[model samples]
Structures are given as C-alpha cells and as structure tokens.
Target: MPREVMIHPLAPAGEPIPLVLVAHGSRDPRAQASTRALARGVAAARPGLDVRSAFLELAEPTPAQVLSALRAGGAPAPIVVPVLLTRAYHGRVDLPAQVAGFDCAIADTLGTVSEPLLAGLVRRLREACPEYDAVVLAAAGTSVASGRATVAGVAAELGRRLGVPCEVAYASAGGPGGADAVAALRAAGARRVAAAAYFLAPGRLYDTVMSDALQAGAVGAAAPLGAARELVRLVLAAADAAAPQLALTAA
Candidate 1:
C-alpha cells in the first residue's frame, strides 16, 4: 500500500486531533484488509472521531510517514494508538523511534490482554469448539523478557476467566509452541484441549499455531481476533486515553 493519510470522510471542521492506529504490518494481503476493517470499525463506533490506520513495517504509511503527512496538511497533533496486543518490540522499540522528533500523543499498546480482548477470544473459542479439557492462549511470542511476561500475565488472567488451566504458548520467536503446550496438557490427562489464537489477524504465525495445535491433538483452535467489536472498543479506549496528551500538544 502507498504511504497516504486515510482521513475519515465525515471529519468535521476544526475537528479534534486525529487518531492514528499503528499496527504491526504484515506481508500477507489479508493482514492489511484486517487492519483496514479494524480502522473502519473504530470510525463507525465513533463517527465524530477521525480514525486512520498506519503500519509499523512491511506495509505503507508508516508512523513517520503518517506524521509527515499530518504535519504537511496542517492537521493538529495526533494521538497514536498502537494496535498491538502487547508492549513488545513494535510498541516499545519501533513506535518511539518513528515518532521521536514528532509532536504526537502516543498511547500504550493494548496490553498482553484485557477483558474486552478476552471476550473476543472466548467468542472465537466457543465458535470453534464447545468442549475442551484445557485452554492455551497462543501468542506470536517474543524473545523480550517484558513481552514474555505480558503474555504470561494474560494467560493467568485468561485462566481465571475461563476457570480452566490456561497455558501460555508461542507461535514463533519463543519457547513452548502451541502444539507442545497442547500436547503437554494432553499428557497431563486432558482429553480435549483447545488453542485460542492471541493474534489480531490471520497471518503466518496465526496459521502456524492453528495448524500445529490442531495437529498436536488439540480438538480445535479459535480463529484470530480480526475486526471484532470488542477489539474496536479497545482501540477506541486506547486512543481516548491519549486525549490529555493531545490537549497538551495542541496547547
């Protein structure tokens, strides 16, 4: 995709600062489609907000490029909300670097997991399978200690929510892949194990874990959390959290 600003069609005169949703770009075409769908959902949920989407890498309209365009267009400073589920590489490293010299309000990443997010996961899991001995929350997996910790935290929360033993597994770049985790659950006497994809969209990692988990004895694996209304609300909240910062920037 070309580097361009996606302004909302209903943007009013002297609109508040724009909301830029920064997603970890993917090479897969479906990834872009998912991201755009998510942006559209956000825009629909809050028609008065000027919501736009950008990529951190492997896609166009990067954070830096978006900032440049916003500045050139005489737009007010934007509130950048990372569409990441964790505060790992993209959130901690790439985002800061991209907006380092720019004037924008940067919100924290969505987090390892949250209630709204878990709702989406649970919805997917229920749709995939009705019965399961154990649940595995499978993330993309990051080598960063903080990222791993976030995943673990989310797993713990998910365990509480489901009232089941939830294990944290990685799809890549980490240890204990989904297949292995599910297998361990089975070895521990679980007859049915289901894997819940922690990914935001369908991509290589999502596909890998979905295949591995199912092949490794998992009865079923939930689909990725793509453009779900729960996620749309979460993204809007992230952008809203940066409102104070946006006000400061405009001042």
Candidate 2:
C-alpha cells in the first residue's frame, strides 16, 4: 500500500491541480491511442483542468517528462494517477520508481473492484453477448498473489451483479487462460459463456485472449474499456480522492 499523504481540502489556494495519468505503456499503438483517448475524456469532462497521459515504459512522454514540463510551466505539485487495474508490480514498484523524484502525490490504482469499473465491465459484456449463462473475466495477468486475489474478488462481484457464474482468467503470466476458463464453464454445464475484458485498452494481449476464448466456444468477447463513460467517471473519482480541493465534478 502507498503511504497516505495528508491533503487539506482548503490548503491549495490556486487553480485546479493538473492530473497526470500514468499507464503501463505498451508497444502496440492501439494501447497508446486508448490511453490518450481516456486523457481527452477526462479533460472534456472537466473544462479548464489539466489532464495529461504518461507511460511507465514502451511509449512516449514518460512520467519524468510530464512532471518536468509541469514544473517548467510553474504548475503546482500534481496528482499522479496510475491507470492500472491491479496493484501489481507496475503499481507497487514500477510506477513509484518512475515518479520518485517528482514533487507529486500518488493516488491509488483504479483497482480491481470499484462500482464504476464493475459497471463498465458489465456494460461491455452485455454489448458483446446479450445472453450468457457464464462469463470469464480476462485480465492481463500479474504474478503478485494479492493482485490475483483482487481479480478474483472482482470476478465474484461481477458474477453477483450479472446473475451469472464468472471466473477469473489471465492472458499471460500464470493462471488459467481464457480457453481453459471457458472450457471449465462449459464442462460445468453452462450453455453460453462470454468473456468480459478487464483491460483499460486494446492490445495484442487482449486480442490473443479474445481469440482464444472464442476458439474455445465463447459466445463473444467484450471490447476493452476504452473511453467508456463509466471509466471516465472512475478516473475523475480517483483524481478527486487524491486531491479533494481540486476534485473535478463528474459529468
């Protein structure tokens, strides 16, 4: 867990602080584009607020670059929001190291189980498969045990919400892949099984998982949470919780 930083609701007496979203960058251009789209959504949702996107690796505009530009522009210490779904290596180690020298407060990860995030998953799943007896929540795998536990929690909550059995699967790293999960659900006598993408953006991993799920008899696979309204709200909420006084009202 990250150390809590005390922020007085009335201390910052100036313009709204900038929000820098730091993502675990990918080599795929689609992933980068999706991150930029989310940043635009944040800025559009809150006019006059400075919203920027940075990457931990494999993409342009690293955290250091963004923070340096902000410092040069005389902007106050900003909140660095990690656009990560789980508190894995990237959130717990990589992100902290990347933004270590910056005079900025780090907010919590988007997390595995949040109301807005769950809703986004459901919305995407429904759009992909209107009817399914079972679902598979496919995530970009993490080696951290705690991170895997959180993914399971999210799967349980999603199952409860959708009134269907949901299992957690991984696209890489360790754990059951999408095909295995789908096959397991079928073996348990499920007629239709669909996959709900637990990714913030589209990339090769996502494509591979969806393909495997479909090949394993999944009905359909939902798209990633790219610029979804629910996701935009979640980002704003994270920013608000980090800096109360500079919280941008969600649209």
Candidate 3:
C-alpha cells in the first residue's frame, strides 16, 4: 500500500474522532502537564474529538508513539494538532518526519496573531494588571529561519489589534531578547510595557524570562495560554484542517 493513505471510517460522519495533540515537550513537569490540560480542554469543548497529548521530545508519548496508538485503535484517520506557538524545528522537521511514510496531515502551530488568542491575553492582562501600557510577547529563540518569520507574523497581528506597537523577543536561542523588546517599546515611546511570556509552563526558561522582563522595567508578565478556551478553538481549527475532507465534519 502507498504511504499517506488514510483509511475511511465505516462509522457515520457524526461519530467522534481520534486526534493527537503534539507539543514541543520540556523537562518541566508543568510543561507536560500543561499540554495534557490543553488536550483535555480540546476534548471538553468538542466531545466528538478523541484528543491525545504527545510530546516531540523530553516527554512521554512521542509522535511515533501517538501514531502507533492511532493505528492500533484502528482509527479511520487521526489529525495531528501541534501545541507549539511557532513553526520551528519541531513543527517543520521533527513532526513531519514522524508522519513522512505514515497517514495523516498536520495542523498549523499556535502562531502569534491568533485573534481569540490575543484577545484572551488582553483580557488576562486587564484583569491581572491594568496599568500596563503595552504588551510584549516573548518566546524562546530558534535558529530556524521560519521561526523568526513566525514571530514577525504574530507581532504584526498584535500590533494591529492593540492600536499600539506590539513587540517580539526571545528568552534564549537566537533572538532579540526580551530586554531588546523593552528598549524597542521605549524607542517607540511606550511608557509602560507588559511582558507576555509565551512559555507554556514554569521552568528555568520561564523564570528567566519573567525575572528579566520585570527587572528590565516591564509592568508584569501575563499568564501563558494554559487551558485557555480561545486556544481550544485554535486547536480545533487545526484539527479540522488536518481531518480528511468532509464538509459535514466541521459542522
């Protein structure tokens, strides 16, 4: 049989679906737990989707393991939903490699300018600390060319939404660090800037980002989109995209 051949379900269209929610796992248990929460939230919103969480690395249930589970369960088709915020190595290379010879399409990552996503952050910021004058989105830098593009894309969207300049910075890897973002805000004439750490959970990176941004004169760091309802919508959108062609499936 040729590769990329997805099996059809004998069950009706209204039947539930099997899905894999992939994440760029971390050594931090909170990170793993957060992904688990995302999968669970997706499942809650759409009971029709059988969501499963898997890590790209440094966590259990790798993509290969997820594929095995799907195949063993005899799922007609399984959609791979990446929990990543950007299309870096895990999204471009590691993810595709898992399904290269296998059957299934991958959904897009949690790219920056998510309308509901950004709104969610705004709301969270307003509730937590309304004094902030600007929002700074910070992520771990990646050497990949596409990674920078992803951040730029998100920053542009955010910039448009807030009616103020939104900036991007990195906590590590190659990047314009968070401090750089603060400087840019200052240069752009922003008086008070808030840091929105894009990290999923608490760990060394998360601590470093928060500490540095706050010390660098940021108002405060907003919460990560951990189990946010808007994020669930984005995840579902990705799932629908990767699911086999069916006009009724999205309904």
Candidate 4:
C-alpha cells in the first residue's frame, strides 16, 4: 500500500484529527518562528497526531479560515489550542466569535501556568542573567480579573519557588508596562534589574517595550516563552481538555 502526504487543506482522506495551534501572530520574525517551532514541537510530542498552526490576528490562517480549510479537506474533527497567555480580546471574545459555528473543538488558552511551564520560565530567568536586583515578572496584561489572576499567580508562585522578590508588570495593558519594569526595579533599589518577559513571542510591541526599558539601566531582557518543550506539553494538555472523551465526529 502507498501512503500520500496531505499538506493543503484540499487534500482528502481519513478522519485526521487536526490539532490546530492557535497563536496571536505578530510582525516580528521571532514571533512567527516561535509559532512554527511550537507547532513542530507539538507534532513531535504526538508522533502520529495531525497538528497544524494558525493565527488569531496580525497573521494568516485565522480560526474560521483554518477550520474551513480543515473541514473541506475531510478532517474528522479539529481542536483549537489557543497559544495565548491571557484571556484578553483574542482568547475571551475574538476567538469565540470567530469559531462560534465552526465544527471543531475549542480548547482553553495555553496559559494554564502549569508546573512545567513555571519551571521552564524559572530556568530561562536563571539563564538570562545571574543577578536579578529585582525580578519583574512581566506579561502582556489584561483587564479581565481572571486572566490577570492566572499570570499573576504564576509570577507569585515562580517568585516563591525561586525565592526572590517578583512583581507583575504589563507591556501592553498600559499599567506598569514593561517599559517601566526597569524603572520599578531601580526605584525598589535593585542593583541589576531583570525583566522576566511573561510573553510567548517577540514582536514590535515586545522589542519596543523591552528596548526602551533596557536602555533605562535594566540589566537584560529575558527571552519570551515560546516553543519550549514544556510549552508543547501544555498545548497538548489543552487540546486533550477540549476534546470530547467519546470522540464525536463532525456534524
């Protein structure tokens, strides 16, 4: 028997269960690369699993478009794994609205702040700079209490686990933005401040925020959390959570 490779959404055959990796796309090359790398990592973790990637906005393969493409290709069911860290516009409103009538499973956002994720974050922090006069656990920021709580909890836990003084800062929410991370640390009497980027990808927002902030005397900007091995597991867990235990076919 001969097997064929299905790349396009038009390709048909078997009820392939598509694990759609959904990310908030950015113009930054790093962000784009991170999304692709994460998708690859997920597929690697689940060898036989049919995994794919899409963007929430500012990129290609929107939810509806990807779902339509997959459905057209005759996939049995597709699960949407939001690569978002917070339940902001994309996770809370945009994603739901986009996939309202779609024939697929919508998994929770990838911001579960799992133990492995926290561990990985801590490890990255350690690697970024040895001395954290004051560690500012930063995030994209959100108005939703639940969303803020999730990231904040992670930061608090990380601080406790790592045994350091950690505080939450936002880069996009306009409150205590990343641009102020260094300033806050300096004000707090930090000798060498480190901005622990609580982000998944790098982009204009991240670059500008960190660049201007670092110039203000912060030691260094820790890399964004993306495509790490633990990240793959987190996304898969989300997919499994969204999937029905009974495995229903697309109607």
- Give the CA lDDT, 0 to 100, for residue 12 in model 3: 44
> Alpha-carbon error at 248 in model 3, in Å?
15
- Give the clash total for candidate 2: 0
lDDT of each: 0.81, 0.86, 0.73, 0.74
Candidate 3 wrong stretches, greater than 4 Å: 1-15, 245-251
Task: Give candidate 2's whole-model lDDT.
Answer: 0.86
The C-alpha RMSD in Å for every predicted model, in order, reads 5.0, 5.7, 6.4, 5.4
Q: Which candidate achieves the best TM-score against the true structure?
A: 2
Candidate 1 ranges beyond 4 A from true positions: 1-14
The sequence of per-residue lDDT tens digits that candidate 4 reaches over residues 1-251 is 11223321211344446788888888766787899898888777766778888887788878788888877876766788888887777888888888888777777887766786886687677778877757777777777889888888887887788776677777666667665766776777778777777788888766766776677776777888788776776787777667662154431
- Candidate 1, residues 126-158, lDDT tens digits: the string is 989889879988889898889888888888887
On lDDT, the stronger of 3 and 4 is 4
lDDT of 4: 0.74
Q: Report residue 198 deviation for candidate 1 (angstroms).
A: 0.7
Worst 10 residues of 3 by lDDT: 1-10
Compute each candidate's TM-score over C-alphas. Answer: 0.91, 0.92, 0.85, 0.86
Ranking by TM-score: 2, 1, 4, 3
Badly placed stretches (over 4 Å) of model 4 are 1-16, 245-251
Rank list by lDDT: 2, 1, 4, 3
